[model samples]
Target: MSGGCAVTLDDLTVALRALRLLAVDFPHLPAPDVDVSPVFPEWLRLSLHDTSCESLSAFEQWRTALRIAPEAVDSRTQSGGRTRVLKAEGQFAGAVIVLTAYADEPAADRAPAGQAGGVR
Candidate 1:
């Protein structure tokens, strides 16, 4: 909340337009299951290559360069791994959601190979 572009009218407008303009190349299959909670945040972290959720907005912005959110949801596909997409600018985090066909499995709860589920 203290870092990155403050959520403002201009910023929100800019954010939404960016989202609408992106071409994420989602799979063609019907989006199986979408969960906007835990899934979304994890997606942002992975896409942005960040260990902490603190830098998510920057991740979102970075995604803009690559093209990428404020929502923390889950999307599950039949074979494609679960992919997370961010919903930025409060409105998006709560409003718009995009879906693609390809999906694997939800890696949200998967622990490191040798670590226990709750170890981290």
Candidate 2:
């Protein structure tokens, strides 16, 4: 919140939308599922499948250890995948982690040179 510019709820919404698009467009990596609470002030929940649970958990722990206003919890899946949940209250204005799934091949491999890569 005290990073730079004061972010409004609307800004968070826009960021969430962008994150969703990235997830849908790139699912092989860390595709994040974002859920925004419809309450006043605004609250955001992000879920993603991380191959490295320890790393994600460490990140969640670091957030709290640093005394960050927001709180984050990292959970593990039965399949050994990791999920992270972050919550912020009162017009939460801050950065949201968007995990992008990495592909073995470059996006360009699936697309003609100079063309954008996307599912057809």
lDDT of each: 0.33, 0.38
Worst 10 residues of 1 by lDDT: 41-50
Quick one: how many clashes does candidate 1 have?
23
Q: Give all TM-scores, in the order shown.
A: 0.21, 0.26
TM-score of 1: 0.21
Off by over 4 Å in 2: 1-31, 39-41, 54-91, 94-120
In TM-score terms, candidate 2 sits at 0.26
RMSD of each: 13.3, 15.3
Residue range 1-120, candidate 2, lDDT tens digits: 325556565645644664555456545443245565434223344443344444355434434433444423322222112222233222223434322122123233344545444432
Candidate 1 lDDT over residue span 1-120, tens digit each: 225645434434433443443334433222223333332322211233223443344444443443333243333222122332333222333333343222222477444455443211
RMSD of 2: 15.3
